[model samples]
Target: MKDSLELRTVTVTRYITPLREGGSLPALAEADDDFKYVLKFRGAGHGVKALIAELLGGLIARELGLKVPELVFAELDEAFGRTEADEEIQDLLQFSKGLNLALHFLSGALTFDPAAETVDDTLASKIVWLDAFITNVDRTFRNTNMLIWHKELWLIDHGAAFYFHHSFSNWEKSAETPFSFIKDHVLLPRASKLYEVDQEFKKILNRDKFVAIVDQIPTEWLEWEGSDFSANEIREVYLNFLLRRLESSTIFINEANKWRDASI
Candidate 1:
């Protein structure tokens, strides 16, 4: 967390409705001072669970040397309602040249092309891999829930991952099975081609370091009304999952060292 960052309560000027036809509640909000930020809140039945998942998953991805966006704790009054009237929202939703009307979509703000692979794609693939390792099933094809900003892929909208309560028990079942980095796109031949980031990435991917990073997420963010799980409980699930995944990774790295005839 940065010391300069501030969280102030603001009234929602107007809610920008979801661009897509179906799914969860996503909104574009403008502050009284004219500062703009996208707000994704709980829908009619769903509470703040999506925000919690996004917050936690974003923290984990950043800790693992994956490129992601800068996330902050944003607060807004609960009463502000939503509408699809904003021109900026319409343009972005339609992927019209009208796209440039949005903030991150602005030139020089971020370097991501959803239709093409960019340099950041390699790292983005690794992030997707890490998400898979942790059973973050949200970043799938239909709703990639990721963005490219500052030449990096930023993870967002993770409420759909680990969504067993939402009739997605299969994803969890696979996570409980053996963890496999081989299947990870980052480990594939096309992605991580040079694997040039091995040293920098390895330094931060351990269980202890990851847990410490998770601690930095604001408690209020994690304690959403929609979530029945506690922060500690979430940490424990991820911690144990990482413990298993790392055990295998440790073996693989050691084997690589032995093959190179270096110290074990």
Candidate 2:
């Protein structure tokens, strides 16, 4: 078999162990000395939306040169048994199995203390920029829909990022009119723990490097009348939008630039 296929097969088997449960993709497998992974089955009803978002959002984030887990399409079979489900079962089988970053399921995979003072002001500012570009409103304290791995932020569960794609007017409100998040939250409280040691992330936030990163975004991920937007056009739209935000910011470009330098 081809290497990618083989890897996919291995990943499926790794997540087979029956362990814990809960969450959209429940925890079935845990940390083990051998063949460890997060057991995920496709028959649950709640995951269909999240799965689609994960796939598309992951692609976009990767194209923007952001850190995320390796995503692969997989099938659940003898190697990976089915899980019991409630009324949500039929919805789950609507799609096939997908293998994601299994290491995240490990109890010790990440040392996360959401309340801990890990995130810094500079890093928070950049994340806000990313969220704004994607229009991701779900990254609030309620969900804190992110995870850290090896001290690096690995974005996950983007089922909420592209809601506007489903309906362009869903967010008809312009970036102007006082947004709720801005009124309350203090982002960029600390540098992201991930940036503290990641050179790749540093390279990514550079003005020239950042624009190049935007260029890599897959056209398929953008939500348009058709998947017809050119990569350059998409990059331009994102850049212009962010530029407007910087122009509107209380700290102006200075804060954004601070992240570029402090991130490393």
Candidate 3:
């Protein structure tokens, strides 16, 4: 495993409040490090795949020089959730009593408003490439899933990307699949440099970095489904799919250009 896999671990010290904006019902909790995080519960309806997306997507963003909030392994002790009077929250805590995921919380960060703010073309292109690469359909205009702090944009909540794992029957073919949904991406209009960004990404990102991202995920999450493949095999499948997508990114780049013209 690459040294990048050494994620900081934090124990949930307090469940401050439930963030109901998302269907998964993430929570704002304080950790032992005196820092707060938006906890993505392992036991949520989205299941472990969502947690994997958060970790993997964040790592990818960081690698590409995007400002994603710090990600860490959050340890959740069952006793910690016992005090929550909310039955729904109690269930979430109970199921998430083991290893969960957390996003390093940013206080007083202003949400991104596309209607009011213009994003840098390079930044926008890189983000659009990433979303398309992962088949993330969640970053639409209505729900940007982005924040801005200190004049820089920050990405959050990537659970909706990488949906192929819900069923692994066609995992290999998924790489060649067209990311048609990216036409509706909130930032696509600003990304007129997709091909160039892909060139840079190809030069910088390699298979080892991809392996390290998967290595950061807990074993239990990977072992649950896919009776045929072991945890390590499943990780390889993810890496291969992403690399394949990179090789064929031009298909989506043309798609985005068409969409940009039509959206006008």
* TM-score for candidate 3, residues paired by index: 0.96
lDDT score, candidate 2, position 210: 39
Model 3 lDDT per residue over 1-264, tens place: 537557898999999999998679999999999999999999997788899988888888888888889999999997988978999999999999888999988999988999988998998999998898888888989999999888889999889988888787687778877778988899998998888898998887888878777778788888775378888888888888877877888887888878987987
Q: Candidate 1 on 2-55: residue-level lDDT in tens?
A: 432222344445444453423543555564556565554433124444554555
lDDT of 2 at 197: 20
lDDT of 3 at 260: 81
How accurate locally, in lDDT, is each candidate? 0.46, 0.45, 0.87
State the weakest 10-residue window (summed lDDT) of model 3: 1-10
Clashing pairs in 3: none
How many clashing pairs per prediction, in order? Answer: 0, 13, 0
Model 3 CA lDDT for position 29: 99
Which of candidates 1 and 2 reaches a greater TM-score? 1
In model 2, the runs with Cα more than 4 Å from the true position are 1-11, 14-49, 63-65, 77-107, 168-264
lDDT, candidate 2, equals 0.45
Runs off by more than 4 Å, candidate 3:
none
